[model samples]
Target: MSARPGGWRRRWILLLAFLTPPCRRIVALGSRELDGAAAPWDRWRIRVHRSICTGCRRYLQQLEILREAAHGSTDRPPPTTRLSTESRDRLKRRLRCEPAKS
Candidate 1:
């Protein structure tokens, strides 16, 4: 059999079609990534993503269980509430954008 001009193009098109993921899967993966120790707003975004993407619902449930376990552990303070004085000073300095005036 002789190859046509479009034969290679057709193979590439098929490959691309196979590699493309469904929109719901993409959203699910994004939600999974954002569910781990992310900010509150990021967690909210993951929740919203999960609401629309049922494929990720199980992943979200797993994340929620993990988060609960982490919270139950008393070994460390919550990330949102724990800040060293040095860190606080650095943030203040960055926000002020200038050395202390006096």
Candidate 2:
């Protein structure tokens, strides 16, 4: 049987997708702006990537949701559970004696 009329076109599009940069690269470019280190070229590339790729647009939208959630958390007061003064002091002394793990 002969190939269908649209099969060749679909194959060509699939080939182009393989050749083009993937969605993760586009999201990485967009994320640089969130980290406060965005370059002009990165913004331009992200805009172009978003124009052509719906998946990257959705990924950026999810990033916005996470950013908003983080911002909202900071607006709230700290939890009610409290460390007693003596316990807090002990913890501080232990922390001072040890290297910071992070």
Candidate 3:
């Protein structure tokens, strides 16, 4: 077979690909990193993988967004409800068994 041009580039690409962890491992590491549970080495590997893997980077971003949103939902204050003065007085009257004021 004839040699292809830029074989060195392909070789370099393949070499780099082999050196990095697979996407699944990187994603798992990234999750741990986000949770502050990953080792420094694993975090470094995840950073390197994210630099070259757009899919993993996007996945991490989405995962982080979801994580923050999940946490944020609990931190928010409960919804406030208001009763109008008229309604409040009507409720008070009913509770006391008093006739409604005309």
Candidate 4:
């Protein structure tokens, strides 16, 4: 059988399939700002996207997991959390008494 017409039809079908509402929705949501609360339109867009797109839903779940993990660690205090002041004379005396490295 001749395959030219069949291949052309298949290509059109695949292109239209990729342009569907759900795919567009997911693309919009995936492109939104990830760091903070989205605007009203963005919120709606994300809602629609998540409702239709399983992959984006899973991506949101993974994002939440990573956010939780990022916040879970860090028991140690920062180095600058404490402050100390010593007299310059005391520091100079200590330095003078110390032996020099060879």
Clashing pairs in 4: none
Better of 1 and 2 by lDDT: 2
lDDT of 2 by residue, 9-72 (tens): 7777666566545788877777887787878877776766666678887888899999898889
Lowest summed lDDT window (length 10), candidate 3:
74-83
Instruction: Tell me which of candidates 2 and 3 scores higher on TM-score.
Output: 3
Judging by lDDT against the true structure, name the best candidate. Answer: 3
Query: Which rank order by lDDT, best down to worst?
Result: 3, 2, 4, 1
lDDT of 4 by residue, 1-102 (tens): 777867986776566445444655555555454665457766666665565457777887777787777677455457866334556677888999999998
Q: For candidate 3, give the lDDT of residue 4.
A: 88
What local lDDT does model 3 show for residue 24?
89
TM-score of 4: 0.42
Error of 4 at 58 (Å): 0.4
Candidate 3: C-alpha RMSD after superposition: 8.6
> Which ten residues in a row are the worst by lDDT in model 1?
16-25
lDDT of each: 0.63, 0.78, 0.82, 0.64
Question: What's the distance in Å from true for residue 11, model 3?
Answer: 4.7
Per-candidate Cα RMSD to the true structure, in Å, reads: 15.6, 9.4, 8.6, 12.7
